[model samples]
Target: MLSACFNIISVCLSLPSLSHLLCLSFSLFLAPSLSEGVSQMFGLVVSPLFPQGYPNNVLETWDIAVPPGYAIQLHLTHLDIENSENCEYDFLKVSVDGVVLSTLCGEKSFSELRSTVNPALYSTLGSMRLTFQSDFSNTERHTGFSAHYSAVDINECDDPYTGCSHDCSNYIGGFYCSCQPGYLLQEDNTTCAVNCSGEVFSSLLGSLSSPSYPGLYPENSACSYSLQVEEGFQLVLAFEGVFDIESGERGACVDSLRIRAGGREWGPYCGNVAPKDPVVTNSNHAEVLFNTDGYGANKGWKIKYTTKAKTCPDFVTVNSVLEPKRPVHQFKDQVRVTCNKGHEIVIGAKAKHHFDSWCQKNGVWSDIEICEPVDCGPPKEIDNAELKFINESSPTTYQSQIYYECEAPYYQINTDGKAQFTCEADGMWRSSDGKLDIPHCIPVCGRPSNPLESIQRIFGGKPAQLGNVPWQVFFQSPRGGGALISDRWVLTVAHMAQVDQPYIYMGFLDARNLGQGVKLEVEKMIIHPKYKRHLGDSSQYNYDNDIALVKLKGKVKMGPNVTPICLPQSEEEGQPELGKIGFISGWGRVKPRQTGKIPVSPVLLYAKIPVAKTQSCTDVKPTGPEIQKEKFVITDNMFCAGMPGVDSCQGDSGGGYAFQGEDSVFQLKGLVSWGIECGSYGFYTKVVNYLDWIRDTMAANED
Candidate 1:
C-alpha cells in the first residue's frame, strides 16, 4: 500500500541566497478531503519535510475511519513544531465527527493541554479528522509534528458511566444493558423490575410460582398471585417447589410467603421448610403473597391450587344482630345485619339503616359497618346571657332544647329574638343555617336617667330651673333643640343639620344662663336617610324620619346635671299605647304663640302630653298645596304625642319627649318633628322604631 500520495515541486533558482530569503511557503503537502475519506487500520501522519521545517501559508487535513466495534487511538511520537502559548499559528487541530477533541501546536505535549474532557489520544466515534495549518511567514525553520493512529476495541463494560441492572456487554464501539431471567428492562433501558405481581389464575386447577422459581428470587420484591373458580368451588393450595426464603433466628420470617382465602389466614411460612399439608380454603378464592427483603438470595417457592366444594363461616359483628339467623352459611348465599332499635350505623358509614353481607366465591363478608347510639354533647355557653335547658329533664341528646335569658338593667337579647336554641341531628345546638342561634346580650337601656319627681315645664308649659330635664340640648344658631344620648352625641332633628359652626347649650333649664353648664362645639351632623326635605318646599316636607345626630367634639364630663339618656327597649318596637303620658320640653315658642315672629321664651318650659291615637293625627291632616297627609302618610315611625293647643310649637323641633318607666327612670320616647299650627297637636318621630338604627349609628361612629 505504498502509493505515492503527492509530488513536491521545488525550484532551485535561488539556492545561493541567505536563509532569510529562502521562503518555502509553497512547500506543503495536503491529504485527501474528509468527503473522499480513508478507511485505514493504521496510519502515520507527518509534516511535508520529515526532518525539516514545515512550510508557511499552507493548510492540510486528513480524515481516517476504522472498522466497526473499534475506537481510533492516536499517539504523537514527536512534536517539534514552532512554539507559542496557545498555538495560535501553525497548529494542528484534531476532531471526531465535528467534536473538537484537541488543538496542538508549539512545543507543548498533549498532556499539558488535555484534562479528561478533551482527550487527544482516543476517539469512540471510530472516525477522526486532522488539520495542520501554517501562517504566511516563519521567523526560523523548525522540525514539525508526527503522529501515529490505530483502531482498538472499546471496553465500555469497565466504564463507570455505563448503566446496566445486572449484566453489560461491550463490543465494537458500543455497549448494551441487560437483565437476568424473569425481569424486563424498564423504559430507561437500565432498571430491571419483577414481572410477577398480581397475576390471576381463574381455572379450576392451576399452579402459582415465585418469579424464576428454579433460580434465586430477586431482592426487594413484593409479589401476589390470586386464584378463583366457580362459585361453589373451594381452593386447596399445596407447596411443591423450593420453599427457601430469607430467614432470621427464632422462627422469624425475614422474607415471607402468606396464604389467605375466605377471610382466613394460613402459615406465614419462611426459611427452608414448606407447609406440611395442603391448605383447605373454605371458599373458591385463594391469594398468596411472596416478599423478599433487600438481602435475600434463595430459590423461591411454588404452589399447586385446586378447587373443591365450598363452605362459609358464620358472620357476626359488634353492636348489631344478624337477620334470618343461620346455622351455617353456604357459598352463593347471603345474610343481612341490622343495628338495634335505638342504635344506628353512625360510625364510618354512608348508609345508616343496615349492612348486607354477601357469601361470594371467597365467603368473606362485605359492606360491614359500625353502629353507635346518637348523642349530642353539652350545649354551648352564652357570652353575656344565662343559658339553661328548657325542660326539667336535661338530656343533651338529639332534639334537646335550651333557652337563653339576658340580664336586665344592662343587657337584652339581640336580633332574631329567638327564645330557645335546639340540639339538632348533627350533634350540635344549631339552627337551620347551622348558626348557634343563641341570643347575644346587647345594650338594654333607660336605667341611668334622673328619678326625681317632675316639676318641669317646656311648652303650653311653665318654666323650670336647671336639672329638671337634664338631657336637654338647645342650638342657638338654628334655634332648634335636641337631647344628649351619649358622652359625645346629641340626638336632634335632621332639619337643623345646616347650622354652621354650631354649638349646643345643655344641662341648663334657663335659656338666659348661657354659661350655667356645658356649651359644646358640634363636630359633625348626621341626617336621617329618609328625611323628605328633597321633595319640594319646607311646607311640603314629609318630615317622616326627621331624626339627626350631632356629634360633640369631645367626651362630656358627666356629672349630676350632665348624664346620657339611656335608649329604651319596648314591646312592639316601643309603640306608645294610646293616652301614654310623657313630658315635652324645649326653648320653643312660648309667648303669644302667633305664627309670625313669635319669640322663644327666656326660660325652658315643659308640658305633660299624652300619646294621641293614630286616627287623631290622620283626621287633622293639613288641607293645602302642602297636603301633609299625602306627603307624610303618618308612617309607623311617627306618632301624635300631643293634643291641640298643648303640643310642641315653633322652634320646638328636636325637643325630647321623655317618658318615665315603672322604675321611675325617664327615657326619651320621641322627638318633636312637625305640626300644622302653633301649640296644636303635632307629629313626632318615634325613637323606639329607630333603636337598631341608633345603636348601629352610634357603634359605627364610636371613638
Candidate 2:
C-alpha cells in the first residue's frame, strides 16, 4: 500500500524518473513538525509518515508561497485524523494573507480550496499558509492527511465582480479601469460620461442640432458646427422639428441659430417658424452657430446638411431659338440653338450661321451667337454679260438664283459655263460647288464649228467638255456610274445601288479631281420589281428590268457642271430610229472584262455605237444551257447597242445612252443594263417604255 501511494504521487506530480527518486526520498524522511517552509513551484503532496496517527501533541504548519501574480490551490485527497466536535482538536486550517478561509476536522476530506485574495487589492501579492494541530492522544490515525497544492496566476480581468464601465485592463497581480475618448472616468474610477464640449465632425454629409435636440435645451448654452466639402461643391442645410428661441419686440432674435457661408451671414433665426427653403452656400465651407439665453427653451432645432456640386449662373445667349431656355446652366451640359430659314447666326463681323454651344468645365460657353436676316447684296458684274432677275427688280435673298447671259461672241457666262449664281445659306453669292470665285463670260469655242465632225475619235470617244454633259454622275467608291434625272434623284442600275449609303460625285470635270466634285449622300433606293438575277434557272442570268432610282438626302444645286438631264415629253419622243448612232458614256474600263485593271481614263469617256436591229441580237448563238433559256431572248423593252471591240464594259452598267434630238439637245434614250460579255453586243433598258413609271415614282417621293 505504501508503494502504491508512492507510484500514484509520482504520476500525479508528473516527475521524471530521477525526480521520482528524490520525491520518494523526501516522502519517507519528511518531518511532520519541521519548521521548514514548502515552496509550491509545481505542487506539493502532503502525508504523514505512518498509516497510524502521529505522536501526541503534534503541531505542524506549512507556509505555501507562490510567485507575486499567482495564487495557491489546495486539494485534500485523504484525511483520517482524530474526530472532535467543532474542530477543537486535530483540526486543519487554511488562511490567505493571515485571513482564515477554511477549517477542517472530524476525518473530513475536501475536493479543492483556492486562495481567497481580493482582486481589488492589487498592491499585495497572493500567498497562503496551512496549519495542522492534534490533541495529546496517540490513538486515532488513518494516514492522517494527504493533500496536493498547485499555484495558478490570478486573472482579475475575467472576474465578473469587476465594475469597469468603459474598459478593463489587467496586469500580473491585478487590473485597472480605463475610459474611451470623449469620455471621462467618474469618481468611482469605473463609470464614464461623454464630454459634450469636445464634440467635432468632418465629412461630406452629417447632422448637427442644439444640445439635447428634440427636447428642451438647457439654459445659457452655446455650440458651433463647421462643415466642409470637396473643392467644387457647396453645402445644403435643411431644418426639421420645432424651432423656438428668445425674441424681442422688433422681431430680433436673442437666443438664435446663426448660419455663415462664403464670408456672408444668412440667418439669426428664432421664434417658432423654421426656414421655408434649405440654405445653400456659395462655397464648400459653412458654419452653423447655436446660442441659447439663460431662460426658457423650446424643442431644439435639428438640421441636416449635404454637399452638392457647384453650378454657374446663366451667361450664354443665342440669337436663334434655344432648346433649354433656362437662366442658369450646369457644367458639361450642351445647349442647342437653331436658326430660322433664310436667317443665319452673326457672332462678330463674321457669320457662323449654325452650331451648338457647350457649357465647359470652367463655366463658360463655347460660342454665344444670335440669328440675323440673310442678304446677298447686288450680284457681281461679269464682262460682256447681263444680269437677269426672275422678278424684274433685283430681289436678292437667301436661296435666290440670279440668271446672266453672255453677249453674242462670249456665250459662256459662269465659271462652270452655266449663266447663274445662287445666294447661299451664309448670305454669300457662291457657285453650286461652294466656289467663291466670281463667274465671267468666256468664248464658247476656240475652233470653228463643223457639221461633220466625227465625235467618237478622241481617245475612245472624246474628252467631254467640263459642262457639256452635266447630268453625268459618277459613283465615288465601289465604283459605278449614274445620270441625274431630277434635282435630288439619280437613275442607275439596281446592282449599282448595292452599297448601304452610296456617295455620288457630281459637278466636276476631271475624275482625278474628284475632291472638287460635290458629293451627295444617297438617302433612299428603289429597284425595279421585275429585276432578277436568274430568270429561268440558276445558270441563266437576266438583267432585263435592271433599273433603280436613288434619292439624295439634299438637293443638288444646278450649275453648268451639275444639271439634270431632260426626260422625253412622251415615250414616242424618246425612241430613236433603229440603226441610228447613239452615244454611251461612263468612267468604265476601256477594254472588255479587263481583269485587275483600273480605268485608263480619269476623265468621262464616251463611245458611239450604232443601235442594232433586234433580229441581229437574237441571232447570236448561246454558248451553254445557261444562256439557252427562253427568258434570255431579246425583248422589245431592251435594245442592243455596240459591236465587238467597241462596247460598254463592266463598270458602265449604270451609265446613259443618248442621241441628239431635233432641238440639238441630247435626250436620254436608254440605261446600260447588261451584256452577254463585256464587249459583245450590250442590251440597254429602253427608257421610252418606262417614262410614265419614272415620272410617277419621282412625284410620289418628292421632298
Candidate 3:
C-alpha cells in the first residue's frame, strides 16, 4: 500500500507544522487513485508466462502500480523449439520495473515469438506490472508466454503486402520496403524483381535449379534483405553446413558469376553453381549483393557468395621435381701428463686428439675424460745411497719443490720433512716423490735416534755440537726422576703429575729459560699405580709403565751437571756388569717437526738409544705374515728395538731409554713413548717394565 502511504505521510511529517500540509494533501489525494488502478490493471495483461508447456515448468510474478505516462510492452509468445525438437528452452526470465529484460532462447518455432516491443525504459516506467519467467524444469514440454502493455503499439503491418517491392516504411510494428532500384526484397514477401535476368536467363536458372537459393539473406530467412545487380546476375549458393570452398578467408566471392557450375563435393558443401550471363559482350556477369543485416543477426547459416576475385576462379595443385643432400663434421683432443721419481706416463698422458676425441658414444665416451695415478712416495733410495733424479721446471701447477742439494760429496741431510707437488686433472702430479723439508733438528749423531732433536731442542737452539748446551736449558719437569727420588723425592713420569695445574718446572733446563727455573709447587706427583702408557704393539707388555714420584716444593742445589740419575737396585743390581752408562738426558726430540713449531731447548742433551730384541725388533719391518694371519698376537710385557737405518724422530717425548748397568753404571731403561714416521720406528717404556711398581712407588713417596 505504497508502504502504508509512506508511513502515514511520514507521521504527518513528524507534526511540527503539518509537514508541508501532509505532503501536499497526500499527493493531491492518495496518488491519483492509486496510480489509476495500476494503470488499468496493467493494461488488462494476459500471458505472464504461467504454467505453459512445450518444454514445462514456468514462473511469472506480478507487482505493478506505476503511473505517470507509462511504457511496458512484453508480448513474448512461445513454441520454444522444434527444429525437430531437442532445442531446449527452460528458464527464460524477464523483468521490468524490477529492471532486467533482455531475453531470447532456443528460437525456431516462430522463433519463440519475440518482442520487447519497446521495453527500454527510464522515466515513463510508471505503471510497472511487468514480470515474465520460464524455467521449464527438465521439460518434456514447456511452452512460453508473456503479455504486457502500457503505451501499447503492435500493428506488425499484418503482413503488409506480404513483401512490398517499393516504398513501405512503417515501424513500431515492423515494415520496411524501398526496392525499385534494381529490385530486391523477395523471400516470398511478395517479391521485388530481378535476381539475375539475362545471359539466357542465367543459363536457364543454372540448368534448372539445385543451386540452393540466392546467397546471404536466403538461408534461414528472417527479414533484412538486400540485392541489386545492374550488370547481369546469376547468384547461386548452396553451401550449407561446413562450407569451406578451399577456405582462403572461407572462399565464395562471385562478383561476376560466369562460372559454369562444374564442381561438386556435396558432403561439406562446395556444390558450385555459377555460369550465368552468356553475352552482352560476354555480359561479364556482375551481381554481388547480400546484407540480411549480418544474415538476420547470424546464428549459423552462412552462404555468402559475393563474387569478385576475377570472376571467381580457384583450384590448383601440380607436383614433381628433385635434387639435394650433404652434411658431416666431427673431432677431438686435449692432453696432460705428470710424474716425479717413480716416473710416469705409460699412457697418452690424458690425450684427447682432434676435437676432444674419445669415440664410441652409445657404449660410453662421447666426452668425459680422466686418467689419475700419482702419489709416488717412498722410493728415494737411501741405503748405500745412489739416487739421482732431476727433471725440474714447475713454477706451480703440478708443482715440484726439489732442493735436496747433497751430491757434490754427499751432505744431503734432509731426513725428509716438508715439500710439495700437485698437478692432477689426470696429467697426474699431485704427488710423485718431490716433497722433503724435514726440520725440527735432524742430526742423528752417527745416525741413529734423533727425534727432531727434542723439537729442535725445545724450539730451536742446540746445534754447535750437543755440548754447547743451550738448547735453551730445559724445564720439562712435573715428574720423571723426581730429582733424586729421596732428598725430598722425585722419580718421574706418572703421566707427568696428572696435570689440571700441577706445575713443577724446577731448576730450568730452558723452557725458553723459564726465567731460570725454581718454580716448583707440586707437593705430590705419585705414579706407579702400576703405570700404563704402552698402548699395544711391542709384544704388548701392558703399556709404558713409565713411572713417577715427585714431591718437591723445596730441596734444590745439586750439580755434576744437574745430577740425579741413579735408581737401579736389582735385575742383578743394574748390570752393565752393573750400572754406569745411564746418561739418558732429555728435553726431548731427536727428529719430528712438521712445523707444528714448538721447541727451543734449554740445555740437557744426552743420548743412548739401544733397546733391541722383541723378535730382533719384530724382525726389522715385520708386522706381516699377512699381519699375523690378520690378527697376530704378540703381547707379553712388550719390548721392541729400532736399527734398520735407525730412527726416533720428533722431540722423543717422555725422554730416557738409557742403559749400561751390569754395573758399569748408567741405569733407567726406556721411556720415549711414540715413533713411527718421525723416527720410522721408536717406541719404548720398560725400565724393566715398572720395576716392581718402581719399588713400590718409591716406597710410598718416602712416607
lDDT of 1 by residue, 381-449 (tens): 755568778654745755677777765544556656665766665656775456766556654444433
All models, RMSD in angstroms: 22.7, 25.6, 30.2
Give each model's whole-structure lDDT: 0.72, 0.68, 0.37
Per-residue C-alpha lDDT of model 2 across residues 1-703, encoded as one tens digit per residue: 0112222233234446545433332343333334455554444445446455566677777776666667666666666666777788777777767777767765553432223222221212446666878777756445676665656667777877677766898876567788766556767776654333435556778888876667776554556777766666678889877776667778888788888888888888988889989998766787787776646757778888887656655545433565587765765667777777667766567765567887654445677676666779888886657887764443687777777787654245646665666887667877767776887664332111221235554224555666666677888665678878766788888778767888779867577888988898888988877776443425435666777899998766655566666667786788857777877777777664433655545778777888887655655554444555356746677888777667786667788887766556567788887676555577888888878778888889976
Which candidate tops lDDT?
1
Model 2 bad stretches (over 4 Å): 1-460, 509-512, 533-540, 594-601, 620-633
lDDT of 3 by residue, 240-333 (tens): 3432121113554311122322222112222133223221211223232222211121222233343211121110101111111112111111
Higher-ranked by lDDT: 1 or 2: 1
After the best TM-score superposition of candidate 3, give how far the Cα of residue 623 lies from its true spot, in angstroms: 42
In model 2, the Cα lDDT at residue 631 comes to 64
> Against the true structure, what is each candidate's TM-score?
0.36, 0.36, 0.20
Q: Ten consecutive residues with minimal summed lDDT in candidate 2?
A: 1-10
TM-score of model number 3: 0.20
